[model samples]
Target: METATIHDERTEEGRRLTLHGRLTVRVIEDISPRLREMEDDPVPLTLDLGGMKRVDTTGAWVLYRLVEHRTEQGFITELTGLTPRIEALMAQVGKANQMTTIRHPIRKRHFHLLARIGAWVEGGIYQFGTFLAFLGLTMLALVRALMHPRRLRWLAILRQAEVVGVSALGIVGLMSFLVGIVIAQQGAVQLRQFGAEVFVINLVGRITFRELGVLMTAIMVAGRSGSAFAAQIGSMKLAEEVDAMRTIGMPPIEVLVIPRLIATTIAMPLLAFYGAIMAIVGGTLISWLQLGIPPAIFILRLQEVVPLTDVLVGLIKAPVFGIIIAVTGCFHGMQVEGSAEAVGEKTTAAVVQSIFLVIVLDAFFAIFFTALGWA
Candidate 1:
């Protein structure tokens, strides 16, 4: 048998309720209806169970129900008279609730895989969206350039030239010179085995004019200028500078993008041309030093081996590379979210994606030209 009694009375500061009982399962069932009576008082209620004995899960559950019912009235609850047994029972119940939510290892792994797949899908979609935005803006810019020639600012174009073109010159120069030197040195070694060291000139010329010069120059620009554009524009976006430009009735694409597109388009071909010259010069120097060939003979053989078509082919690829670089930069910049880390990540992605696409495009051109009997 179970027994209990509740005495509710007023106190100096508030109301106090005392329950005295052997809190067995039957007693809890009887007291549940009485506990609901405490809700009439709007003041804070304190449950004093100092005389509670033999309390079990049923009693703890009754207490929980009372606390929940009191919550509906927005009254604060304080549970006192917590004996060790009652405390332990409550803790066990709470822990049991928590353990119910424990997940299996296989389930967790499945979720992890799903999360990764979701992330990859999201990335692909975001990149595709950015590419579309870049294309749309590019089309708009081209239309404006054709229709509103007087509105084009030459000063902005020159500044873009200085920024994207001149700023990238040193890196392009160094890379091309090193690439030329390495190719010449390797060619010289292979040619020396056959006592035909002079063919190294033809090797360097054909490789440079057909592949290395254009590819290396584009890669350098992608790393240097592409990243720069992403960082600059991403920072502007983060700081709301781009928004300010829009607020001022300036088309951000016209004021910012047009200059860059024109600059890179003009500068990239010239940079490719310069890279070829530097590569030839470096190869000639390497031939003179290692292969014991005179500069005059190296230059003569280079001209004879590399046709005008080869040079034009390299140049033809440059503007395409430039467009790729510009698009990647602007795309990643606009994709920047609300964090410094996002800017850095987007900038790095811009460079890597631009360079990768440039190389891939170059390969496609090579294969296409070969198929057309043009390579």
Candidate 2:
């Protein structure tokens, strides 16, 4: 590779800087200070690139900066004798640098607290609108799939069901079981003071089946399957597979989102029921071992005290929770941009949003059910 050289010539019209040999990183490093100095010159400047043997982004950037600086200072700066390829490369680099420079001005401004708060509110409103739009599109996709069952992807739905439901069983069961034991032990300690230790079974059954069972299961699914959905879809997006599907006349929601949503909705009620059963078993074991209540007695008390309606209440919430988790995950996944960091960021957002929405919906259900005298 030829070493780059810069030769400056001063004429009546302007100062011209002729670049020779390879205009690359090493050459740019050597000539950067010289280019900076040229920017301060009062005369108009012209850069002659015809003598350059090669050019890359870094070299083009240095030249772009010099031209921008000179122009900003009211000096006419021009490029002369450039081939089509180098001119195109320089134009591309110049545009990118301009965007970066434009962003810097915004960062330099001091934002007041009120201004920041207003900006946040504005962003929230925009995001809410976007989410509503997404929801509408998903609903349309669902309708289309229903009308044309042949468009439904049964294989994908089954695969996602296994992933979102069957695989999550062990962790959901263990979490509920441990939570049940804690509730029983605490209740036993408190009830013993009142000489009602056996009431632990009633407390566990009521709380687990009516509230904690479905709530805890939803949260666990949000953290596990929701995050997985985000990561999977985000990776596909990053690979341009989602765009490719669209280019090929495939609806992404139908191909990707519907299967996961349907599977999760189908699976959650079953998981919630399983978790409730596990929780009851754990409470019963603790009652038998610690409270000295026989297993038979515990079972009899649970049957007598806890109504079937209580169990049904929890199961009723499961499908709604599933829809929230699946939709939130898939929504954030589709929002991911073109980078690895974006994928990770959106995945985190999906889990957080899913869990937050699940809890919020649970609260609404609690209120509505209580108002209806179901609680």
Candidate 3:
């Protein structure tokens, strides 16, 4: 517990800090302020440690920092007359500090486009690998549930269905309705120029049934239900509830993910069909007001022009889109780690990735249906 002292002297050569007494914790604590004053001094510093009776890790670290700081600033710092033991202690401290002291990655001066692209591709590959693993885990859970139907949580599926489908009807219907109106108005205007304004009925019916209906519902569900899944599961992750379930021999995929997957998958086609109906109603209203078509005639024309094939196409894609949304949300949710901030980040990622994947799937379906002569 011996206290150390620093003797600061300035000469024509440089500044000198001479240590006296034992250089330990108490002494370092007391001399810290005095040590800091030397930081801005650009002149050479000579640390004379020979007078020190003893030194410890704390003392060695402080002295090493002073030397390192001055050296980094392009100023000279010399340690003179150190005993072999103290010199050895200082060397060990220097190595330890270099290993972990305020470690940060040094930024590169310039990165080429190819380097950035390579990094992006590497990250994407890693992400895809993780997603495939998650998919496999989910499939295993599905198989387990199929093998033992009693283990399946039907109540949870019903609850999630209400949340994902029933609760979402209002917004989906409203958005689809508004979108339908826009499609009708725009179609009527453009077709009017060619003396084919009545064709707007065909335009609205085919577009709603074939594409916009299910696609809009999927987008809405991705933003709403997808984000909710990520946030809900991610919060459980942060709370360690997921881990606790695992500790208790409960597989999270079977308990948490499968119910949601079933609910969304079943609810999506029904929701899409309902949304398409609402959109057709909206188009009907617009046709009456803007096109001078009676509701009766509009319905009759819509029935004649739009085939059952379009409805089948939309419904076929809906369940797949639903599966995409549920998997992305739950996958990203389970991926959350560290702090609460990660929950929000993964939630956003869930929504964005779900929407992006949904659009990509939609495009693929469009091409597929066209090749099958459905278009």
Candidate 4:
């Protein structure tokens, strides 16, 4: 036999309904009048469906519609007498009021922020470790090169020099010229206040010969040529070309990197010299126009104020920066993972870390020169 019970209780101003046993569609139709009776009251609707044994989807749908009707009328539906499992099932089927019960959105946001910071710190550590590893390898390569000078391939070195050095000329020249013009204009304004506009030539010459020429050239190389080296090596790594070289019993350091290192070291100093010349030309032109210093006076002042040692110092930093750049590029290249995204990321890290190391090294040189009464 099938049996069901519907009980009603009266509060101070409202009625509560308790339903037991299976709530079929027919039972809901029979209880429509009782539901209508409670609809007139301003109190919340309480549906005690605790004894519900087996609810069909139709019963679940009916309960959802009742909850929606209560919500539209600004009355809350309190579902009491439900087992935890039934309550969970109701929530899962979208028949229960589960929307406003979520906890702690701020904690979720805080965790998200922490995750981002952790990722950034991890990346920083990896890049710093890569820089250190490259530094060690470069020192090793340098020792090997010195020990086996005959093994250094001159043809490969010259080819790399032609590629990295010769190809960099146009961009370096343009950058140097623009830098010189800006410096001259600034010096002209400052010197004019002191009735020393002619000294703009000395200002441009000393600044360029001392720092700007070498530093700008290094930065450009880091961006342009260093990125190229890293990307090329990274691509080779992805294609397993580096592995093929290894399989063929070729020393990657000797055949690939050593040649590049030698070429860039030789070429960087020469580029520094050319860059200094372009800067002087640009500064001279700017001084002629703004400071009223003729090309002859500019040349004489430049010769007088610019020590030959300043040019030597500028050129001296180039090879060191070049080695740093190349080694960093190769290290990050070799660290490339299997994915294209990883290759690109490591290549970018190489250039950024190279530029950072160059500036840091330059700062050390600046301090060293100042201590020696050179700057």
Ten consecutive residues with minimal summed lDDT in candidate 3? 98-107
lDDT of each model, Cα atoms only?
A: 0.84, 0.89, 0.92, 0.80
- Which lDDT tens digits does candidate 1 get at residues 1-375? 759888888887688889897777877678877876776557788889898867779777777667766887798888899888887877776566543566656657789999999999998898788698777887688678869887787898899888777877788888888889999999888878999888888888988888889899998889888898899889999999999999989887777677777788889998998898889989999999987889999888777888888898889999989988987887788778789999999999999999999989999999987887767
> Candidate 4: which stretches are off by over 4 Å?
1-119
TM-score of 1: 0.73
C-alpha lDDT of residue 304 in model 1: 88
* Backbone collisions counted per model: 0, 0, 0, 1
Pairs of residues at least 3 apart in sequence or in different chains that clash in candidate 1: none
What's the TM-score of every candidate structure? 0.73, 0.73, 0.76, 0.68
For each of the candidates, the C-alpha root-mean-square deviation to the true structure, in angstroms, is 10.7, 9.6, 7.1, 10.7
lDDT of 4 at 332: 80
Model 2 lDDT tens row, 73-157: 8989999878887778779987776434344344323566668888999998998798889888998998989999999999999
Residues 205-306, model 3: lDDT tens digits: 999999999999999999999999999999999999999999999999999999999999999999999999999999999989988999999999998999
Error of 3 at 287 (Å): 0.7
Worst 10 residues of 1 by lDDT: 96-105
What's the C-alpha lDDT at position 217 in model 4? Answer: 90
Question: Given candidate 3, what's the lDDT at residue 294?
Answer: 94
Q: Candidate 2 — which residues are off by over 4 angstroms?
A: 1-111
**Ten residues in sequence with the least summed lDDT for candidate 2:** 99-108
- Candidate 3 residue spans exceeding 4 A from truth: 1-114
lDDT of 4 at 285: 94
